[model samples]
Target: MAPIRTFIAAPSNLGLKPPAPGVAPGVRHLPEHLQQFSFASRAGAVQTIYLEPPTYHGDIDPETRMRNADAIRGYSIVLAEQVQDTVRAGRQAIVLGGDCSILLGCMLGLRSQGNYGLFFLDGHTDYMWPEHSATGGVAGMDLALVTGNGHEKLTDIHHCRPYVPEQQVFCCGNRVPDESYVQLIRQSQINYYDLDALRRFGLPATAVQFLQLVETRGLDGFWVHLDVDVLHNDLMPCVDSPQPGGLSYAELRSVLLPLLSAPACKGIDITILDPTLDPDGRYASVFVDHLTGILQDAATAVL
Candidate 1:
């Protein structure tokens, strides 16, 4: 049977660049917005824990060369501790994020337990070095940081560099192209499948392939990183950076359901849903519906 689901809300926008000077990104409210729609109840969450994030700062930290780097680093450690505690108790964590950077904390926590694989589903690869990043926001460079591509500060947390091995990761659903970071990810050992690749190989098949890899490698488990922008911009336009093409609700369900059904799947983090863009809550409501439905369906299938 699937383990009990525990929702951890780490609503810190320190990973993202502010829209303007001294203005915090509205993405920080992601957890609260989803909870307003009763996401935890609908997803059958047994417990809900909210981590208090550090204050957001707009200035770039000289040491890390990333905006709000200091705050983000501290928050990631705190977030990691909570994730470790949740997993140690034998619960499946469904982390509600402030941005993609929270992936660091999730992975760091998993690294402490043992080696784990990653299913990184996003519209952009998010694998850029600090020098290549235009905004210097850790959100854009999360995948890189987690893979030990950046400075020691963020990557060497707990003296564990490369939280999850590059070879153990499966980066899927990236639609953006013709970028330096895209090239970077392609050169890495991570199994990369772009939007076209997903269509060519088939979504469900691709997920199964990752699962087989995890089993054969004898990983402790795997984590799922679901950035909401992976959904078609028409369907999920409330994200920070929306592009032309992405997955639809049904398409996402087809892929995510299989990953979530696996006993080896440790946790999944949902990120980048900006509530400010959906004032009437139409998009957020549908998002909640589809997500909760997928989680429920996965549980049933495993049973």
Candidate 2:
């Protein structure tokens, strides 16, 4: 039987620093914007689960030094519960995000089920400590937090530290050059693949290698965290942090098709696309078309 797809709406931008002082990041509107195109129906979602986040205060928490720190922690806990329920009911979850930090909740929820691997595709590495962060945005440090490298409150949720082990992680698409924190990921056990390496390795081959890592490690499943900023700036400039080099839509599809087609691939969370930036909605339309088409193709192959 084909698995039911559940659209999990996680419209929380509390993880990012305000784009302007006292102004919250506009990514909170991503879910509704995508819905304008019937994203749920087009993606074959039978049920939609919406998880509300705490209000965006745009202030750094004294305890964690990250913007809306406790709020993000609370929201993550709730999001995890929703994910656990969807998985228990034997449905595939398609998580829509307010920012990349939502990956914390998705991975935390999957941890309760069994050991899982992670395929992190983003334009930046997103690995750093709060002290190293100039803005104290969790969205930029999510990879570090998920791998159990940050504050105890966020990292040790439900006493499950390192939600997804670093060794089982495959991080790709980082194009940032000469950033100090990029070196942090390089020193970690996580398999790192930069944009240049991805092109050199070939997208299809990279996807195969990720799958092999998941299968050989005896993981129950794996989750894919795709920050749309991984798409070239010309293609997807609506992200909170747009960068220079990234995959084209065709390149993204080439890599995602194989990863999403695998039965062991549990689910994926799409994040960091800010609707406010794309006022005309043209970018959202293209993103929806490519993503839904990929989901459809993956479903067909899986069945």
Model 1 misplacement above 4 A: none
* Pairs of residues clashing in candidate 1: none
Global Cα lDDT for candidate 1: 0.90
Global lDDT for candidate 2? 0.90
Worst 10 residues of 2 by lDDT: 294-303
- For residues 231-256, could you state the per-residue lDDT of candidate 2 as single tens digits? 99999999877778789999999999
lDDT of 1 at 103: 92
**Structural RMSD, model 2:** 1.1
> What tens digits encode model 1's per-residue C-alpha lDDT throughout 131-242?
9988989999999999999988899998999899999999999988786558889899999999999989999999999999999999989999999999999999999898
Candidate 2's C-alpha runs over 4 A off are none
Please list the C-alpha lDDT of all candidates, in the order they appear.
Answer: 0.90, 0.90
